[model samples]
Target: MTTSAILMYVDVWIVLCFYGYLLKIKKRIGFQLGMNISIVMGGMAALLSGVLLITQFPFHFTVITMISTVAGLTVGAVFGLLFDYQTFVTGLTNGIIIGLMSPMIGTVIERPTMFIIFLHGFFIFSLLTIFHSIKRS
Candidate 1:
């Protein structure tokens, strides 16, 4: 696998493990804590990814960065609202949208290979599942 693909896979795995841990301790802050943490992490990931793309890639930054930031904020806010509003369905729907958009955004910014996109999607969906399980439990 390419370096980027490996990174994406590893990132996903890390996110899954982290989210799992949060779920385990979710009762302390209430069940919604895991979801809250995930949203923050996701937002940070998007921001960091955007910064990385602008710094490391050949892409234009002006529009791409703005788009990425907006996307990140939207996803993050939706995630937060999912927990705050106690709307699991809304969260899942937003997750689905983010999952679909992530790879496309990744490609547009980083131009990663197909494998990278697959890995990205896999991790994102995994994160969604983790949250869903936490909510159900």
Candidate 2:
């Protein structure tokens, strides 16, 4: 795997582990917070997967879109399952829409490296936000 792809995969692992942590305390999470968590996780996962996969395999937009969509749906569904059905559906639908659209954004970008770095930073920020929110609840 390329360095960027490796990093994205590592990110996926980190996010999954975070989901595991959330699963342990699912009861403490309210539906609104659950909805937010699912949306953030799903959208970010789709965006990252789409952009990185497109960068790595630029010639295969169709396949990459499918892959990214699945990634988003999976991540969203996993997180949403900890809460409720409404959260699950919301995440799933958001993932579908974002995953479909993200590859085009990837193609239009002038600087993939910088964008990816910023995205990862944003992902970290999102995680910290969720963690703090969880702590507050």
Best by TM-score: 2
**Candidate 1 backbone collisions, by pair:** none
The sequence of per-residue lDDT tens digits that candidate 1 reaches over residues 28-93 is 545355455545455545543453354345356556555545655555554444345543434444
How much lDDT does each candidate structure score?
0.51, 0.90
The residue pairs in collision within model 2 are none
User: Candidate 2 — which residues are off by over 4 angstroms?
Assistant: none
Which lDDT tens digits does candidate 2 get at residues 1-137? 69777988798799879988987899999999999999999999999999998988899999999999998988888787889999999899888888998898888899999998988899899999999999999
Number of the top lDDT candidate: 2
Clashes of each: 0, 0
Reference-based TM-score, model 2:
0.97
Which window of ten consecutive residues has the lowest lDDT sum in model 1?
87-96
Question: What would you estimate as the lDDT of candidate 1?
Answer: 0.51
